[model samples]
Target: MDNKKDFLKQIMNDTGKGIKGYMKAQVTLMIITFIILGIGLTIIGAKHPILISAGIAILDIIPVLGAGIVMIPWAVINFIIGNKDMGADLATLYVILVILRQFIEPKIVGKEIGVRPLYTFIATILGSIILGPIGIILGPLAAVIISSIMKTKKKTDNRR
Candidate 1:
């Protein structure tokens, strides 16, 4: 029927618009996340510049463990080399990084996922548990999708 065709066309248009909006939001959030992460890493590097920078860069790819993975090893190396002062400083920097990761990273990730803080935490844990490192990335994405579905359903119900 002509009406059915028109409805389908309208739906396609709306979907296109939504996809565009979502992509824009994602890019914006990614930029913000990078900025925040850069600032945090910069602060960590202020004291033990070389070690922290190298560690953070190396762990950049890993999901939850991230820079902590690199930083811990770097600290151990420092200790083994008999640089106790540097090792202690690196340890302090690692602690800062961990705190930032636990408290701040979630907030940044939540903004990117467009989900609530609680949901983000739950998704991260559930996702990591089921999927390992990859799960961390997928978890937030899935949460966003689920949230979007719920929101659309609510809108439809309201109209009805």
Candidate 2:
């Protein structure tokens, strides 16, 4: 029916708009995250070149784990090998990176997703479970779209 076609078209238009907005926001957030990460890594490298180099490499792949993955194990290995000074150095670098990431990364990711930290965390977990890694990207997008729709509906209801 013509009415059905019109409704579908309208839904598509709204979804398109939401996706466009979400992408723009996400791109901005990604740039900011990279910049912050780069700066933090640079600072750490300046202070402790070896530990930081390893830490940054791991941080590049893992989002939330940051440098902890590499630095923690490196520290442990150093300790096991009876290199106390090396272990201490790696531990110090790890602590610094963890502190910086805790303060910065969450905010960057939160800004990018345009969702609160808690909601973003929940959405990521649920999204991954439901749609795999793609869900992590799409989940926040779907949340934004749904939020926009709810606001629009509420406005329309107010008029009625």
Candidate 3:
């Protein structure tokens, strides 16, 4: 039916927009992460801070691998090697990164996707709980799709 086709088309278009928004949000987050890590590493007097921060930022984007993956182990090694101050600094930076990401990710992603940050946050948490790491991606995606569907339905209803 023409109505069905129109509905599908609308949904598809909105989904594409949502995907674009999501990608933008991710890139923004990645850049922010990179800058923060770069600054922190430099302050900590780490050699090759830019390169290391870039690597960790890339890893942070990948599921189940994050700045902590490199940072925590490196910190522990520093402690083992009798560099307690460096270890403490790394640990502190890692905690700061974790806390900041938790707060910022949802806000940025939600703003781009045109959803409330709370919704995105809830979706992220629920998705992580139910589906594990990949849920972080899937949850926002599901929210975007559902939001598009509701919008499409409302438009159609208004026309009728």
Candidate 4:
């Protein structure tokens, strides 16, 4: 009974750590995104650069809507008003934002979760492919869970 309790406790602690790792990754990504968007908007001479960056960062937290929700409409509005240069710049910024997310997400997420970044990246991509949009989050999470379980099992086996 005591051994079982210890085992359970260990697993629980590992899970807690995993959760923290995920949180760290999420916060890091969000900060990086906000900084990049803020700097880009400032460089482009957009009015209220800080407000736009803040808005983008907040929007990024929503899995369904994302930055595109605001950017796409903004882009279109600029085009309609015949501000082609601004519209094009906005579109380009959006593209860069997306590309950066794709490249950094797996590495940062995986680093926090105790898995190799490459494996995490592959898992994320595969998850996205198999499960659609939600897969990105689910994939890395699943990997972390599985890896933690395996670590627990190995420790148990060694004790025996």
Worst 10 residues of 1 by lDDT: 28-37
lDDT string, candidate 2, 128-158, tens digits: 7898867776776676566556655665567
TM-score of 4: 0.87
Give the runs in model 2 whose Cα sits over 4 Å from its true position.
Answer: 1-58, 63-66, 121-142, 155-160
Tens-place lDDT digits, model 1, residues 1-160? 9555654555555444544544554455434434444565566454555454544554555676666676678779988999876677767766765665577556765664467778888887899999998887777667766776666656556766
Model 4 deviation from native, Cα RMSD in Å: 2.1
Give the candidate number with the greatest lDDT.
3
Sort by lDDT, best first: 3, 4, 1, 2
Worst 10 residues of 4 by lDDT: 57-66
Judged by whole-model lDDT over C-alpha atoms, candidate 1 comes out at: 0.63
Model 3 off-target regions past 4 Å?
none
TM-score of 3: 0.95
Q: What is candidate 4's lDDT per residue for 65-155, written digit by digit as tens?
A: 5889988899899999999988998999989999999899878888898888988988777888988889877787778777877888899
RMSD in order of candidates: 5.3, 5.2, 1.1, 2.1
Cα lDDT listed for each candidate: 0.63, 0.60, 0.89, 0.84
Most TM-score-accurate candidate = 3
Quality of model 4 by C-alpha lDDT: 0.84
Candidate 2: the clashing residue pairs are none
Error of 3 at 83 (Å): 0.8
